[model samples]
Target: MKKMISWNVNGLRACMKKGFQEYFEAADADIFCLQETKLQEGQIDLELPGYHQYWNYAEKKGYSGTALFTKEEPISVRHGIGIEEHDTEGRVITAEFPEYFVVTVYTPNSQDELKRLAYRMEWEDAFLSYLKGLEQEKPVIFCGDLNVAATEMDIKNAKANEKNAGFTKEEREKFAVIKEKGFVDSFRMLYPDTVTYSWWSYRFQARQRNAGWRLDYFMVSESLKDAVADAKIHTEILGSDHCPVELDLEV
Candidate 1:
């Protein structure tokens, strides 16, 4: 069995100060993925004894970024999708393994008043296409802060958040399309009625009240569904607004 973990650290440097390494050592995941690292290259030197690290830094510093650490090195690693337009933010990293590809994406959020919704929609289509392209060669396992509370059950206050960025109808539909296209949400597939969330806002003591959204996820190609041994939300562990999600695969 391989243990895969994904978390949005919010800021790598800040998270490090908050016991990130301690959690990392305790978890001991085979492949650990991170989003919203919020740092440029050379900003920090992270040493993980046995894991190889790969990072994609945003052109604009301290904005968006992703990193992947794995015990076994990948055959190849790609920074982003081919499109130059969507690649600048450094939100994606794809690592090719012998049996599957692991992708970590920090999807762009449709800020404040849904000002960036149009661009986000464009990104959704392009990103999904990129994943499908990779699927042609082998099964794909992708995870990170997707930034959408996909279903009504995914958000604590779905009715109040209908027009909000993460809970917007448009964003929900896009996530549904991903499911229709053969990607399985490992957590939801395993625990259909369970109520859990991966992200929470800093305002109003949201995390304390458990008013959160299930924005982070581990999605595997339909063919790998049976290989999913467990899916978990590490709500008890805290270093950022978003907690870590785990996927155990019996590969």
Candidate 2:
């Protein structure tokens, strides 16, 4: 089986200080992906001998960014969804291997009072189309902090958060559309009713109480569903507010 792990490191440099290297080495994933790196090019040097590193940095300094480390070199790599309007945030990185494409994305937050919901909706449409385009060639294993919970079951306090950015009806509907478009939520597919989460807020002792939202995900093309051996959340390991999620594939 091939193993892959994805995490929203929150900040790679800060995470490194908090035992990121130890966890990275121990996890030993075939492919590892990260979101919210919050750095510019050359900001920090990471030495992972056996892996090829690919990064996309937001034009704005100290903001959204993503990186991918893989044991197998990809045939090709691309950044963004090919939409100039949505590409500025350095939110996406796609690595194409012989069998499939690995995409890591740090999806945009709708922001306080849903101020950015309009743009986020646009992003959802374009991103979905981009994945479908890639699927024309091969299956896709896309992972990262998706920034929204697809259903009430995905969040701890669904009723209370009904109007919140990540759990709002608009965001949830968009997430549902992705599944409708030939993708399977790998973790949900394995543990359909598991009450686990990937992200928590620092404000209200959320992680301590395990009151969090399932924001990070690994979604694969529907055709690859049976090849999915296992899916998991590494809630025990911690460096950021969010934890690592893993997927094992028969491929």
Candidate 3:
């Protein structure tokens, strides 16, 4: 089985201080991924005994970023899907394993009041096209804080936030394109029930109240569905406002 875990630690230093490494070891994923590291080169180095690390650092330190810790080094590693504009945020890391391509992303948020909504919408188009290009070569396993909730069932009070950035019509439609391209959202595929969430707003004591959103996800080319054994959201494991999401694949 190929087990993977992804989390937006908020800040690497902050998360490490709050028992990040302990959970890292406990989860014991073959491919462990992290987002929003918010650091640059030389900021931190992880000593994961059996894993080879790949990091994509934002041009601006302490900003958007991502990393992958893989037990098996990829035959090749690519960043940003060759999109120079998106590369600035260091949001994507693609690792080519023998059987499939694994991509870890920290997609751009539209920001407060949907200020960057236009850019984020453009992002969805470009990103989906990129993933499709990749799938043309091999099956793709894409996981991250996609920053958009694909369905009304994905977040608490979804109707209340219908006009919000992540749940807006444009965003949802773009995500629909992913499904149209034959990618399966693994977690939802396993559990059709609504109200399961991976991220919560820090304010209003959201996590404590279980008032949250399922913004993070794991998706694979539909052809690989049988490889999916399990998908999970570690809402009970807390540190950042967002918890961890995991996937188990027979690949």
Candidate 4:
């Protein structure tokens, strides 16, 4: 079994001060993925002894970034989807193993008032296409802060959030298209009725009331669905507004 954990650290430097290292040591995941690191290269040097680290940084400093750490070295690693237009934000990193490809993506948020909704749609199409291309070579286990609450059950107040960025109808349809393309949402697949969330707003005492959204996910190709041993949301662990989500695969 291989244990994988994905978290949107919000800011690596800030999270480091909030028990990030302690949690990392305790989790001891075989493959750990992070999104929204929000730092340029050389900003931080993590001292994880047994893992090989790979990072993709945005050209614009302190904005968007991603990193992956694995106990076993991958055969190859790629930073982006190979599209110049979409590659600039450092939103993705893919690692290829013998049997499967592991992708960590920080899907862009449709900013306030749905300002970035149009670009987000384009990204959804391009990103899904990228994943499908990888599927042609081997099964995929992709996870990160997808930034969408896929279903009504995924958000605390679905009706109120209909026009909101992450919960907008347009964004939800893009996620549906992902399902149509044959990737399975591991958490919902295993626990369909469970109402758990990985992200919470900093305002309104959201986390205290458990008013959150299930924005992060672990998605696997259809061929690897049965290999999913467990999918979890680690709400108990706190360091960022978004908590870590875990996946156990019997690879």
Candidate 5:
């Protein structure tokens, strides 16, 4: 069994101060992916003895970034989707392993008033195409904070957030295309009716009230769907506003 975990740490440096190390160690995931690292090249030197680290940092300091730690060294690694327009923010990291290719992404959010919605739409197309291209060579396991609630069940107050950034009609429609392209949302496939979320707003005692959104995900190739043993939302183990989502596969 191969255990994989994904977490949007929000900011790696800040999360580290809040017991990220302890949780990371205890989880013991074979492949651990992180989004929203918010660090530069030399900002931090993390020491994970058994795991090799790969990171992609945005050109702007202390902004979007991603990291991947895996027990086994990857055969090859790619930092971005190769689209210069969308590559500026360090939002993607793909590692090719023996049996599968793992891609961790921190999708850009459509900020308030749907500010970045246009660019987010372009990203959805380009990123999905990139994944399909990789799937031609091997099975893919892509996971991270996708930044949208694809359905009403994915958010606590769907009606209230209908026109909000993450729950907008455009954004949700884009998310639905992912599964239509032959990928399986591992967690939803396992627990289609489970009303759980990985992220919550810090305001209004959202986490305590269980008012949250399932912004993070673990999606595998359609061919790999059967190999997925278990998918979990580890809300109990938290450091940032988002908790870790886990997947166990028989790869």
Candidate 6:
């Protein structure tokens, strides 16, 4: 059995103040994927007893970044998926195990003014292509904060957010391309009618109201569907604006 967990911690430093260590110890996942680390080089010093840590830091301090903690070491590891421009934010880290490659990405968010929408579109296309390229070699288990709500069911206030950054039509269409390229959203597969969520805004006391979006995800190549055990949202765990997503599988 293999277990993987993904979370957008918002800020690594702040999460540490809100029971992060406790959550990490209890998860005991085979591989843990983290996004929005928001740290610079030499900023964080983790001490996980049994996991090998791989971190990709942004060139800018206290900005977008990602990390992975894997109990099993990969045969090879690559950063940024071979794209120079996309690598700037430190968004992706790929670890190739004997059986599969785990790629974690912290997708670029279109800001409030939606100034980055065009760039975000480019990223979606490039990222999908990158994963497809990797699929030629091995089954892929990709996880992270994708930033967009792929479906209307993915957010509490879907209609209200239809024109918003994360639920925009263009963004949603790009995500559809991913599904067409043969990836399965593990969580939705297990519980189709379930309306579980992974992220909430600090404003309007959204978390307390259970008003959130399913921004984080665990996806795998369609060929690996039979290996999926369960996909869950750990909404009970509080710390970041986002909660954690867990995947159980026979890898």
Q: What overall lDDT goes with each candidate model?
A: 0.97, 0.95, 0.89, 0.97, 0.95, 0.92
Better of 2 and 3 by lDDT: 2
Model 2 lDDT per residue over 213-250, tens place = 99999999999999999999999988999999999999
lDDT tens digits, residue span 17-45, model 1: 99999999999999999999999999999
* TM-score of each predicted structure versus truth: 0.99, 0.99, 0.98, 0.99, 0.99, 0.98
What local lDDT does model 3 show for residue 52? 94
How many pairs in model 6 have backbone atoms within 3 A of each other, for residues 3 or more apart or on separate chains, i.e. clashes?
A: 0
Model 3: per-residue Cα lDDT over 1-251, one tens digit each: 88999999999889998999999999999998888999898988778999999999999879989999999989999978787887899899999998899999998998879999999878888988999998889999999999888888887888899888788888888889889889999998989885698998989988888888889999999989998999999988877878999999995
Pairs with steric clashes in candidate 1: none
For 32-99, candidate 5 gives per-residue lDDT tens digits of 99999999999998989999999999999999999999999999999999999999999999999989
Residue 223's lDDT within candidate 5 is 93
User: Tens digit of lDDT per residue, candidate 4, span 1-251?
Assistant: 99999999999999999999999999999999999999998899899999999999999988989999999999999999999999999999999999999999999999999999999999999999999999999999899999999999999999999999999989999999999999999999999999999999999999999999999999999999999999999999999999999999997
How many residue pairs clash (N, CA or C atoms closer than 3 angstroms) in each of the candidate models, in the order given?
0, 0, 0, 0, 0, 0
Model 6 lDDT on a 0 to 1 scale: 0.92
State the displacement of the C-alpha of residue 242, model 4, in Å, after optimal TM-score superposition.
0.2
Off by over 4 Å in 6: none
Global fold similarity of model 4 (TM-score): 0.99
- Residue 165 error, candidate 4, Å: 0.4
